[model samples]
Target: MTAAEAARQVAKHPIQARNPIQVLGRSALSAVRMVGGVGVFAVRGTIAALSPPWFFNQLLRQFVAIGFFSLPVVGLTAIFTGAALALNIYTGGGRFNAEQVMPQIVALGITRELGPVLAALMLAGRVSAAIAAEIGAMRATEQIDAMRTLSTDPFRYLVGPRLLAGVLMLPLLTVVADTIGVSGGWLVATRVLDFSSAVYIRNTVDFLQGWDILSGLIKAAVFGFIVALMGCYHGYNAKGGARGVGRATTHAVVSSAILIFASDYLLTTFFTHAAK
Candidate 1:
């Protein structure tokens, strides 16, 4: 090949090789920006929540919506999860002739991990989507803008209440979930696994510590904040039209789920070290 042609071929290959790198870099940068945006949104909402002229009624409404209405779903999920966990642990333990320990394992697993994680995951799917869709619709319809024009701070009126409610209610919901989950495990152990109910309950209570339950609640609070923050952040930034709102809702749920898992790991690690 001619020198110029060879040089051109070499340059073309470099450009082609660099294209994927550029795309990846852009993706990383976008992720960073998205995370930063959510962080800023959370900070703003927190500040608004703590400021004067608080909206107690709005906060109360959100508390009921997020906590009270969410009970059925959370409770059902927790119970089912607990029963399944007990069955699995019993089966696994039977293989090693350790079936009697299933009660303690079930209790520990539920309180230290599954209760907060599963409850948060369920809430992320239900609550995050709802918040995102509502706020996205408001943004699409320019109602948020209208509120600003009427001297209403959208952050305080909209985002703050949701954030506060999530932080407060998720722990409560998780506690209910933990109780249901433990009870379900006990029921399954007693009925299906032929375990003594009194023995199971006694073992569970004996094996579980206050810190184990407290750690789960703490994790729930963080997950709750993540869910609400993701919902509000995506909804607030939604653009385009109906399509944009739909995208925001999808993003909110997906992001909240991911953050829940990620934060769960971090919190679990922290708690483990703290226990040490």
Candidate 2:
């Protein structure tokens, strides 16, 4: 191409100084709408979940699947995380002769936040993507339509169980994570950090209160609901064929993970204000 033509083509795609501002506005608008939609969907689904026979069945199945089945993996993750956290904190605090804080800090930090939040994220990645892909495939292949023809409400049949399971199980998994994590911390503190088991346990118990555990459980519940909703929403709405289902599954995981962090900040802010 001639120099003039090249220059004109580049000009067509020029980076305007106002480009960032326009992009920001568009992003803000999209986010607002997205949040509104998700909230509406969640509320409606929750209403349906609380109605009659469907609710009880979903609740039981979910409780078993989410709380009982997730125990092993959650426990394993928590244990290692707690041990690592104790070691790191001890090493860092040693500089200021504050190694005494390790046990208590580790317990409070894990029980109050990390244990529940991380466990939820892990479960979201595992469960949300799976649900999304499954639902997306069903939708793509007209299986969902067949369910309607058979007089089944797809939301009640498919989304309800998974949603209930996630919301109910997360808090249970979180409790498991907290317990295992604290135990791990205890092991490290006594064996590697040269702290006495009695001192470690005492500090851990003394520093952690009812509010801390309650907060963690609440966060787990929110995380669980978000993960399930995101998965179901994406999968149920998936387009195209197998490729589309895969893409939806990926989107569900990414979106669910991002939402977890964003919600964590909001939940922390609320907890901080409440404590104040």
Candidate 3:
């Protein structure tokens, strides 16, 4: 082939080949950029939360929305999860003739893993989506712009309260979830599994350590922050009017759920090593 033709053929071949290495490199860069953007957003949010002109009214309203309104769903999820856990544990332990260990295992599992994770997942679905939808709608409608025109910082007025409330309230909700979950396990153990109520309670109480509960609370706090952060980030950056708001709502929930699980694994690993 002539030099010009050979050059054009080489260019076409590269385009057609679709190099795996190049594809992977592009994906990795995109992921890094996304993570960096999220980090910057988180820093700005934290600064806004700490600055003056605190809005206690907004914070109180968020408390009711994130903590109180979330109670029924969180509680229901915890109870059913605990019941299923108990039944499963009983069945598995029965194979080894160790069914008596159900109470202790149930308590440990709930407090250390299930309680905070389940509660946070529920909040991500309910509270995170709500926050994103609200803020995204405000963005789509230009209400955020109007607030800025009125000399109001949207971060301070909008993002700060939800962040504070989520960080503070989720641990409390997780506490309630832990209680309800343990109670459910107890109910199943005593009623369905035919375990003695008093002995089961005693085993659970005796086996559950302070660190187990504390670790779960710590996880809850982190998950809470993640939920709020994801919601605010998506909502604040949303565009495309109504469609943008809808997309933000969905992203908030999905990202919060994914981050919750990811962070839970990290925290669990940290706690495990620390205990060791």
Best by TM-score: 1
TM-scores for all predictions: 0.92, 0.86, 0.91
lDDT of 1 at 216: 91
- Per-candidate Cα lDDT values, in order, are 0.90, 0.84, 0.91
Model 3: lDDT to the true structure: 0.91
Model 1 residue pairs with clashes = none
**Residue-pair clashes per candidate:** 0, 1, 0
Which portions of model 1 show Cα errors greater than 4 Å? 1-18
* Residue pairs with backbone atoms closer than 3 Å in model 3 (clashes): none
CA RMSD of each candidate after superposition: 5.8, 6.3, 5.2
lDDT of 2 at 31: 79
Candidate 3 lDDT tens digits, 1-276: 875574455455656536776555555665887899899989888888888898888889999999999999999999999999999999999999989999999999999999999999999999999999999999999999999999989989999889988999999999999999999999999999899999999999999899989999999999999999999999998999999999999999999999999999899999889889
Q: Give the TM-score of candidate 3.
A: 0.91
The positional error of residue 181 in candidate 3, measured at the CA in angstroms, is 0.5
Better of 2 and 3 by lDDT: 3
